[model samples]
Target: MNGSYNLSSGTHYGSIGTATCVTGYEIHGTANIMCDNNGYWNGSFPDCIPVDCGSAQTIENGNVSSTGATFGHTATYYCMPGFQLVGPNLLTCNASSEWEPYEPNCQGMYPYAIRK
Candidate 1:
C-alpha cells in the first residue's frame, strides 16, 4: 500500500496478513487476508483513508477556514472585527486521528481602551 500500512506475516501461501492503518488514518476494507494456494491474496485489498475530523468546531464570534477535514488538512481560525483569537489560529489533522493542539476559541477584544 502506498500509505503507511503494516502487513502481518509473510506473503507465502497459507500465511495470514493483517492490514492496519497508521495513526490518523482509517481502514476502508478487510483488515485481514489469507494467502491462497495459488500464490494470490484472498479477500479485498485494504485501504487506509485519511481520518476526518470534520469541519472545525464553530467558534464564537469567529469563522474558520478549512481545506476539508481529512488528515493533513489544515484549518485556519479568524475572529470577528471586535474579537481576538484566544489560542492557536491554525490546526492540522495529526496522528491518532485527531487535531493537534486542540481547537482555539475567540475572545472579546481587550477590555480596556488603548492609549497611544
Candidate 2:
C-alpha cells in the first residue's frame, strides 16, 4: 500500500507516466503524474488498499452465498432439491472486484428417465 517512487538517472523534464500497484491492492488517488517544467515530478503518490467486490448476483433456480464481498472472498452456489448444478459451485472475488470463474446455473432433474 505504501511505497516510494524511483526516478531513473539522467531523467529529463516534461516526462509523464503512470503509477501502478501490486496485486490484490488498488490505487486510492491519482495514478498518473508528470514531470513539471522544473526537474521534479508533480503530485504525490497514491496509496493501495484491498480490492472490494460489492456483491454477487442471484442465480437462476439457486441461491448465492458469500463469505465476504472483497478480494480473496468466496461466493458459493447452492441448488435446491431435484436440481442439478451445471457449473462450478464456488467463485472468488479477484483484485478487479469481479467474481472469478463465471456464474453457475441450476437445471431441474426429473425423478425418472423416459425413452421411446
lDDT of 2 by residue, 1-116 (tens): 44344454334676655667778778888876778777777886788777898898888889999998888999999998889999999999997889989898999998677778
lDDT of 1 by residue, 44-63 (tens): 88898888877777788999
- TM-score of the candidate numbered 2? 0.66
- What does the lDDT read for residue 35 in candidate 2? 87
Model 2 lDDT, full chain set: 0.81
- The backbone clash count of each candidate, in order, is 0, 0
RMSD of each candidate relative to the true structure:
3.8, 4.4
Clashing pairs in 2: none
Candidate 2: which stretches are off by over 4 Å? Answer: 2-4, 7-19, 31-45, 111-116
Q: Score residue 38 of candidate 1 by CA lDDT.
A: 98
How many steric overlaps does candidate 1 have? 0
User: Candidate 1 — worst ten consecutive residues by lDDT sum?
Assistant: 1-10
